[model samples]
Each structure stands twice: as C-alpha cells, then as structure tokens.
Target: MYCAELGISYEIVPTKFDEVKKRPFTDINPNGRCPGAIIQYIIEQYDTEKTLTYNTLQERHHLKQWLQFQMSG
Candidate 1:
C-alpha cells in the first residue's frame, strides 16, 4: 500500500517465519528479521525518489520514531 503510493512496485515473497530463517531469505537479510529489514530494503531499493518514505531529514526522523512505535507499541 505505501509502496504503491510512492509509485513503486513491491514484489511479494510469501513465506512463513521458519522459511524466512532459511537460505534464500538469509541471502536477503542475514539477521532474518523479516519485515523490518526487508521492508526497509524494499523502500530503499524501490523508492528511488524518497516518496512512500520520508523525503527530508525531519521526515526521516519522524518515520524512524513512527517505526519504533509501530514495532513496539
């Protein structure tokens, strides 16, 4: 949804958590912390214009804070 807002195409790789801990997923993220690192990777790789994400430093900081809330709270 967010990626689409940024005009980026997100390719979904449907896999369970156990599968994510395996070989191919590890190649994408060694730590295997599924959506956190993976979504960040996708945003970085695909949101070339900084759309779907923060376009400025202040916005980036806000996004970081929001992510913390999202992941924890």
Candidate 2:
C-alpha cells in the first residue's frame, strides 16, 4: 500500500514454499524466510526507476524512515 501511495507499481506473486519445511534458524532472520525472500526477489526484479520524483538524499532518507516505521509498527 505504501508503494502504491508513492506511485510505485508492485505485484504479489503466488508462492509454493511449504512453511513446515522452514525451521527455527530460517525464521530468525526475516530476509532469510520464504516470504521475505519472495519480497526481495520481486523488489529487485521490478525496481526500474532511478528516481522517485528526482532522487534527493533527504527525500530518500525520509522515505526509508517512513518505511521502517510502517514495517516496525
């Protein structure tokens, strides 16, 4: 939804990874988990924009902080 608000096009892909197969260690790091991996994959594959309304450091940092707040809470 944040991406949508930022005018970034995104899609959710179907996954077939069995959650049962992913154990304790795998779940420790969010990025190491299946769902996280899928998200990373999609982000890498889909992000083609070099700038979001012109890439300024302050604007980028604000966006990053906003995303952190959204994800953490």
Candidate 3:
C-alpha cells in the first residue's frame, strides 16, 4: 500500500513456515514481528543503491512517526 502511494515498485517475498521455524527468535514478537526487520529487508531489497529520495528531513521524520503509530496500534 505504502509503496504504491510512494510510486515505488515492491514485491512481497514469502517466508516459508518451515524456514521460519529454523529461527527460534522469529516468533517472539508483537504479532510475532518487528518493523525494523521488515524495513531493513525492504531497504536491502529495493534500495540497494540507497537512491530513494526524501524531499526533506521532516518528511522522513513524519513518515517514521506515522509508521510507529501504525505499528503501535
């Protein structure tokens, strides 16, 4: 959803349940997850050149806060 809004192309890679089981700590999270891990994965996958743009630092901060709110809720 966010990628579409931001005009970025993204693909959702599926993680196998059996593969996830090999890592014990993967399930010990809120909803069994962490935003940073997902964010890092996206960054690594799509932003390999680190070329994504933010018109301003404020926009970045605002997006971060908004993501935090969504995660918290």
Best candidate according to lDDT:
1
TM-score of every candidate relative to the true structure: 0.51, 0.38, 0.42
At residue 8, candidate 1 shows an lDDT of 62
Runs with alpha carbons beyond 4 Å of true place in candidate 1: 6-34
What clash count goes with each model? 0, 0, 0
Lowest summed lDDT over 10 consecutive residues: which window, candidate 1?
A: 31-40
lDDT of 1 by residue, 10-33 (tens): 687677868867898789877555
Per-candidate local distance difference test: 0.70, 0.50, 0.57
Better model by TM-score: candidate 2 vs candidate 3 = 3
Ten residues in a row with the worst lDDT in model 2? Answer: 31-40
Candidate 3 per-residue C-alpha lDDT over 1-73 given as tens digits, one digit per residue, 9 for 90 to 100: 4465445777877776445434554555435344555663564466644455344689767767766786675
Model 2 regions more than 4 Å off: 1-45, 50-54
Better of 1 and 2 by TM-score: 1
Q: How well does candidate 2 score on lDDT at residue 68?
A: 60
Per-residue lDDT value at 39 in model 2:
38
lDDT, candidate 2, 1-73, per-residue tens: 3356446677866555654245653666544333334333444455456423226788656766655665454
Ranking by TM-score: 1, 3, 2
Q: Against the correct fold, how does model 3 do in TM-score?
A: 0.42
